[model samples]
Target: MVADAIYSCLPDPKEISPVETAPDPEDYQFLAVGFWVDKGTADQKAREYMTKIRNKKIGVFGTLGAYPDSDHANTVRERVRELLKENDIMDLFLCQGKVDPELVKMMAETMKDDPHHSMTPERRARLKEAEKHPDEDDLKNAQKVFEQIMVSLNN
Candidate 1:
């Protein structure tokens, strides 16, 4: 969704999703990379693409499970930024992404019997406190952020 917005803003955008293959920097002067956060950083494929990019104009965007402004999210952002190397990282657009609740439930069930499971009072409270997020505002804001980066880069 974010990529679609960024692509629309561009004079000519070649839409591609980097998965098993990374876009060759030689094919384009500028690149927009988007990925989902995993364990406080870009997932493995995105990280692979990031390392391959060097000395190019780059726009970064992604989604995360954590609220955009939370400390955990901020720390993840910092770690995400670290993914850039030898490139001009123009900007980052972050938004909350839906995580599979089934995964969470599975974890809870699987760890319920684990001796090492730390279902501390605090952890339990935090889990309960987390609410459904990434409303329309988050999606809109992410698109806006990507558009702004495109405008700035064009200038």
Candidate 2:
């Protein structure tokens, strides 16, 4: 959804490609990579792609299970920044996304024995809150952010 929102605002002559099937960076003047955060870090594929991209204007947008402005989200953002510190990151945007109930259930079962398990009441509540997100407002904000990114890329 975030990628769709960003694509909606991007100029023509643009192509969206998956990181697995990435095209040559030299073929495009600007690039935007979007991914879902997993285990508190940018997706591994995104990190790998970043390593191959250099000397291009780049923007990153992604979704997480945490609220967009939460401390956890901020830390994830900082981690992404560090990961791409060698590249020219034009902007970074993140928003909350629904957690998979199946994954949550599996995690809960796996952590049932651990005292410091992640399936705490607070975590479950946060996951519940995430179910409503990447909502209309989130998509709109993603579009706006990418629109500005496009403008910056043009300049």
Candidate 3:
């Protein structure tokens, strides 16, 4: 979704700039960027561009489009291998189209454990007041129902 969010913000592919400064690998240590490559660009030239990004110490990650390849799978693999070898870049790999159900369950479990994903502190404080004063039975019941839904998702 980060890719979608970033892509939606872009004005035009040309305006996005062909080359970006090597982002600090540590700051963007596990970053992944997906883009559409022009069919005319030679694989060698593409590898050269990836090398430039690698020199900046950022881990360059991307996915290749299938449409350009006559033998799509093999072409993608060969191109990926060529880029890896030439760029001295590691940790680059293909990305999946959607999150799996298992991953969704895992995310649900993670959200339950992480307080930062929960209600805001101010909201929690108000809820705490409600708990002590025992007002608004309907709101309390709704909170219980929300908690059940979260629990069910993880299960």
Candidate 1 residue pairs that clash: none
Compute the lDDT for candidate 1: 0.73
Query: Which sections of candidate 3 miss by over 4 Å?
Result: 5-28, 40-49, 53-70, 86-155
Model 3, 1-155: lDDT tens digits are 32333333333321222334434333432223333233422245445555544432223223333222235435564566455453433333332122234644564567766774444555344334433322244224333433443344346
Query: Arrange candidates by lDDT, highest first: which order?
Result: 2, 1, 3
CA-RMSD of model 1: 3.4
- Scored by TM-score, the top model is 2
lDDT of 2 by residue, 1-155 (tens): 77877887898988987889988777888888887898898889988887777777788899999888898899999998888787788899999999888988998999887876568888888899899988999999888888888777677
How many angstroms is residue 90 displaced in model 3 relative to the true structure, after the best TM-score fit? 7.6
Return the TM-score for each candidate structure.
0.78, 0.90, 0.29
lDDT at residue 119 of model 3 (Cα atoms): 47
Clashing pairs in 2: none
Q: How would you encode candidate 1's per-residue C-alpha lDDT over 1-155 as one tens digit per residue?
A: 66665566666646566456655776888888888888888998888878888888888888776667788788877887777857888888787766677866776788877765545565455444443445566557766776777688769
